[model samples]
Target chain A: MVVATNSFPGSNGTTFSPNDILDLEKGDPLVFGAYWKKMSEVCTVVIKGWELMSYLSDAKNVCWFMLSEFGDAVRRLHHLVGNAVIQERYIVVGTGATQLSQAAIYALSSHSEAPQPINVVAAAPYYSEYPSEINVLRSKLYQWAGDAALYKKNEPYIEVVTSPNNPDGVIRQPVVKSEADGKLVYDLAYYWPHYTPITHQADHDIMIFTFSKCTGHAGSRIGWAIVKDIEVAKKMTWYVHMSSIGVSKESQTRAAKIIGVICDGYQNIGSIESELFFEYSKRILRERWEKLRKVIEQTKVLTAAKYPTFYCNFTNESSESYPGFLWLKCDESIEDCTSYLMEKLKIRARAGQRFGVGPKYARLSTIGTEDEFNELLERLSNAD
Target chain B: MVVATNSFPGSNGTTFSPNDILDLEKGDPLVFGAYWKKMSEVCTVVIKGWELMSYLSDAKNVCWFMLSEFGDAVRRLHHLVGNAVIQERYIVVGTGATQLSQAAIYALSSHSEAPQPINVVAAAPYYSEYPSEINVLRSKLYQWAGDAALYKKNEPYIEVVTSPNNPDGVIRQPVVKSEADGKLVYDLAYYWPHYTPITHQADHDIMIFTFSKCTGHAGSRIGWAIVKDIEVAKKMTWYVHMSSIGVSKESQTRAAKIIGVICDGYQNIGSIESELFFEYSKRILRERWEKLRKVIEQTKVLTAAKYPTFYCNFTNESSESYPGFLWLKCDESIEDCTSYLMEKLKIRARAGQRFGVGPKYARLSTIGTEDEFNELLERLSNAD
Candidate 1:
């Protein structure tokens, strides 16, 4: 086991590679995956689309209950991506996938007279925010019971399975397979063609998706959950109505426009080269991952997540790892990889402890500006 | 006392006055207060403002945490309206004021070890959705404890004071005046110049405001709270972060633009007539109220909410009742006013029972289109 260290080399006479030189004073852009700026030219149409006379004039687009246009857009995007089955699924819009995640937990939990608060669990190395988000309300309907691997109760529980998982970038299924009935909420926020291969069409009881991840428009804050169960969908819708009186109509309209653009690009694939959002995003993500992998391999300070090659039905080709986040496991000696990277290299990373894992691991966001990605590569290459 | 009857005229040789006729089947626009179409000409400039190239190019505006533009706009609107003091308040944004209301409830509740779930109460004839919204979460931190007048608990509780209250548009103060330490959350959603007289610069510890009611941009779904206490503000912000990972950035930008337009109109008051949103809205609301009062008075089936004439600081005149919703009390003989209107005249109104009030009262939204108001008036006048 290679021991990872935070200590700087003091007069070791080790020559730094020219490629390893990076400005440490400048902060790392490994915090969020908002890649809007990277595809500004292609997304310019979205801003221009808002100026249409019908955009503001039509009250028909913003029905208080839900916009059919938005629902249709969501359905279209799923169909275009070929990641999730749109048919026989009720789409419930949320402020974001964050809201939908909690809504799913609430929907799955028992709401009977003798209310039993169901335990909500996710596999280890989960999305960092899930635990806090679930427990924030300290709700009586459900409680965050930590990692699903440790969840031993035979009672009904909710297991969140984030495919192309947030920090780790691994396709996951429910770990808590039990004789007891359990509800699985598939967080397919990163199941888009840009992030991963569409190995199979996800047809879960509850699956959540967001425009933030799909189009790198995190600012839009539009998310939807495809639910097979009508009762669960109704419950989720009720939760949304009670929470925020429904999602933002403005956001929904923008999302619908963006989704339409994406679909249009796919439909006119031979006609558009640089304008195809999915192709552009996938290429950028793949390149960034490849560059980071090459640099990190040279340093040998951290090991990245290895993904098995899968044939993508959407792209009609074999695909490698193109995750939004690069999950890095620091060499054994690094007690806290996040602290090591920050203190020594001035590179901020989310600690694995946040994701119900030990401190030897950290997660870096791969979706950022090209300049930021280059700077991240320079810093990581100097890790040794 | 005259009784409100659901009984339609059954060939009693009663001549139907053509002057008192209404196109009832044409449908009422009482559903939404989206005034985008009305202000489209002035707001067209806003849509065009997005085309300045830098609008979509600026990734800084869509920060993950909070937008300063939104915060500044909130402050400017309050200053422009002169309804609330914003100098010392920390502004926290929400998906809508609906979200902030629940956030305030969550913030006010206990977070201690052996957490005591506090009671949440609003006055009788309160906002109709308060009960359902509060209880839907079924949170351990707080529970919907019904009418504040009947609330006998000496323990800690939260009292929601919705000035220019929803359903029944009456300015309200906290009903539960307990010596026990209780927090007051002022839901000033309709305290804008268009809805009511700016009685005073409301200096409350916790005050909530929304762009939906003020600017008639219900589709934007942007609401904010001016919280005095640092801890409360932090908690509210955290709740927002966990609830939806913050409000939509697209909504925030739109709100900021619309608010900027409103403020600009105020700044250039003499130059424009119909372009001013607040002035236009106030005139519409005032005229609609007058028309509604005239028709309802002649019918003698229901009585409207009475308001004391107060010297307005914003408009500089003694303003009459210009409520968003007309709180109509049915005659003593009538049990359900909502049912009576719906059954007899195909008119739908919010049931009084939803607001913890007697079935003898109902609420009609007066902020709808001119056509809806006219139809409602014609139906009410012909009610015998």
Candidate 2:
């Protein structure tokens, strides 16, 4: 069971330290679930790229049905970050990772010669939307087949491995352990430096990534996948094409500019004090985790999973916990953590049952504004 | 069989008219298929909408998981254009009309408790993509059941009606005569006043519209649907959410602003000599049709369809031929119109077979730049 927390603190009679005024103001309440304050900061730094305006008028970019400069930018960023392998991989862009997730499912199962619908499994405590997203199509290609851990089938199946899992933030592997015609689709949406340590370069058959989690450009709705199989890539691209003709050219162009700015910052790391996007993002995430931990430790109402230090190749340092979401497990005495948090502390959270868990766990977003996080800490501190 | 034509005339004996001064400089050859040149002209008119900037910062617009301002704008435009009835209808926004097309198919088919897969049919010589897009999913809920005109089945079915048909410019109705259990999805993509006359308000159960053909903002990738059934609307919205997480906020916001500019221009009509967007767009399309017809008449190599003039209520005038695509039929001597155009005239076009018709017909886009259309005319004129 896990509980994720993202709250803003009340100013009066709070044991928690006050958040920075600049940070508080930067956290525009208008953008829920987006890290725009931090993004705006980075955007301001690279505000003078006149070349970006060319994307606005370039008709070549508009007809980019197969691949765009945005896809190139994504590949370059992945190479620079050393998160995923790009060489010999066919990249398929989508509206978001959510779209790509379904695209992958379709590509993997649609062409299968199997007579019956193939089963799709993800480990329990999975991203809540996976089951619904997969089953909603009612496609004969595949069907949602409950939790991977409980699956006893030896038939053809596809296992989703969401590393740095959505609700719990734990590194995960496929639990079904099927060797007979089974496939693995790695959803590395939260495997960025800000969320987790870049322990190793991911070299999976199929992997998905999103700009939303990476750059907090959730509004752009741009995501991509790196597939080793050319056929799978083509099928995925076809799905994207038929789904929306192609991802938005305006969004893709803007994404390309934003990604280019990020890559440039990383390339010229030594000259700037902020180092790069990841450096600043990691710092902010680490600080929030530390402050939240202090408040939760005092409350004893909920406990977060303790993660071990890992050697990050990009930073060349031992990094602690810095996950996108906080998975908090409620005390046994609390029957429904999601409801308890909402009623007692006025903090809304996703209940664990949604992720195929019991009522004692809930997930809260830790990647919101500074004010929201501070409020969550204050609420937790005073709840007891 | 239908052949859509979008061609431009060439210059003098030098194989280059005065277009080298503009076309060569504007990078015309690079974007042969896109509507960028024409789109850029329209974009310039609404370039100063300062409200668009707020969309960049306002996350409220980003987290709008439900209906958005873009949907509202789309409804307003539909009402102003007298295309689709918006009152009491739920508007669901999508990446483009393409996404909404699939969404409608899914919504109409997935919820049925019928024992067998629902047969999906469209009239022959339909939008060629209907079969491929529907069958690609290989969903058990629905399957491509072939031409609606020839369908003799008594079972449940969904019929697609693409008015101002893609390859052909003729307005269409459902060919399937089963009113008992038959469902119709109206693809009114080219039903705008610019492309066709506003004969009467379209009040279908499910209707799809696109910004690509309307405002030529193909790059924006925004489209919408007016669904009469609330349940169908909710299911369509669910499909969108699971598909791309509610479309790109940036794209939607931009679409809203662009659509707003269009509607505002119409509200203040007669004040400006340019009039509204449809007025300018219709003028260009009408002029192109006239020029292309004159060239085709002189060649006697191919024949364009002659559409009847209709009194448009919106513009309060009798409107002539103004279609998004020109459906051309090659002379009896030419077996394959698409190849004949390419081999003899060096002009590219989509074959009629793609639209489930005989090879004698071909489609060309009339929505390109002034130079492209002129170049096409030159190529046709020289071919004879």
Candidate 3:
């Protein structure tokens, strides 16, 4: 117990120091710090050095590397909130959704004996990392074949559908109208009730989720793939095994504890428990969106993206979508929105070119620290 | 603190149950559980939900995902033990040594402009998984070329040198003779004082170490590369980011705590901090190897691998190598030792065929639970 004293950091929430740069280029999810800090007492986890020592979690399961606790937590979370369907699906855990996505790419294309790598395509303005992420391997099995919306051929391919997508937060389905049936890897990262309306339970063949976006625990580096096919699940597990051996058990244990707390908080709504994770995050994100929209209206030099209203099955209420990242179009006078903001306003935003679009559009993360968001608004209002 | 009660699983250490089957095929490292259990009080880690909120650890470091605490611990341990060159080296963390190895392959082969995948070679009787591990990527930049010792060409290639090698615990170095310069990825997984003598501070260009093998924390899923070249470190970092974004912060935090405990125990040798890690583990491994050799003598049907004696710089004492695995050769009458052990004696051992050797030899993991090892010895001595 004395040895644990040094490690048991006081549950006063994340100790954050303000940075000079109000950079919102990446959705780093430091904004989730405040919420977790509020519930810090209930969110802290204690692990022993000798606990969970084995590399294999459950040998009987198809995904032998995934912890039984984590698998249960994921299934329970999805079941609690009407998100992805979990029954009869194999839960294969990975380091993160990035690894799972790559695994999906590998698993889908591995069946083909063709010499050429299978084409991997996503819609225009996809997650900026997709192209380079896939190309990083330079695998002979697959290659990034550009935007699916522009792909003219009907040849077999791997289609990535980022519903309640990354850049724009617009609800989307597959746009690839290929006659040949291609495999689908659903990037349902933002499909949580906090971000968008869960119109229907995601019944996709392969759906990936991350603890970072779902519970604001990006540092945990835990994610899972709800794979329908047993062989694909096994292959994905093989990919993870070949890559990282498996996800960290410490991370999985922490994830399991956090998810349990979130679920318990919801179930014990009238009790001594604190705010539900989804409700707390949704309120913060909604407020951030409103403030950004007001700043955009005042500036009249930038255009904030608009979202369609939809009824959520989880909340059972009509609301506009609140995306984690803000996609803004530049005014006609500005040639490059990202550079203009960086140079003139001292705000850092990811340029549109990285997302397979022109420089006229740029992205700023709404899920930054409160101070950073406020600074962003101040800088936007002062824009010339 | 009320929330902490549930997550604070008591550090009584590694609740292990003896299994029906004695599986000695894999080097899972559950043997370290008992040592940790002995130091359970000082071995537990407590983490708050809001702590380590961001995805990045240190933005300035080449390995942005690596915690500064972990980096410091690594440097201190290597410095204390005199096993590696710590100065001017860049540390890149991965999920495990498996991922780091893949990253090393990518880093070494990234600049090759050749249309064909670069050859990856290891000597015969090499690590069993090397061939398939490299081939799994099927990357255009690299391919498994097999047997570095027998490559009869002058072509550029990537060579892997696993010192204190996996199946056989023998210290090794680059064996290839080529006119054109080739790159080396030194897998120093078993180079610790427990397995072999620290002949000299390993000054290999790209050296990798794993927490699983070093500290016996495989479930933590943390491994690092001590890369001499800045470019290679950066490229490995890029590969990690593209694959898994980064290693888990919780895993790093726990590793930092455990490594700190180990170092502190050694420094405060006269105090009541319990046994030093290396001292404890080395004693256990030596006893296991001795017991195994005695059992082999009792059987008279198998010959145990004989290692040369040397003085360890860390221990400052004369000792013969105590391998984590038992490499044994069956009698010439037996065609396949693996099948003979499994079918007749009910002992599971990895056949030499997987290691690119004939089936006369087999490997049994010495790094398993005490009961498993006892059972292995019992099964071996009972061999007819």
**Model 1 lDDT, residue A299, Cα:** 76
lDDT of 3 by residue, B166-185 (tens): 88887887888977668899
Best by lDDT, which number? 3
Ranking by lDDT: 3, 2, 1
Question: Looking at candidate 3, what is the lDDT of residue B56?
Answer: 79
Give candidate 2's whole-model lDDT.
0.71
lDDT of each: 0.71, 0.71, 0.84
> Which candidate do you rate higher for DockQ, 1 or 3?
3
Error of 3 at A358 (Å): 0.6
lDDT digits (tens) for residues A128-174 of candidate 3: 99999999869888999989898777678899999889899988889
The candidate maximizing DockQ is 3
How good is model 3 by TM-score?
A: 0.95
Better of 1 and 3 by lDDT: 3
Residue ranges of candidate 3 with Cα displaced over 4 Å: A1-20, A269-271, B1-20, B269-271
DockQ of each: 0.28, 0.31, 0.50
| Candidate 2 chain B minimal-lDDT segment of 10 residues | B46-55
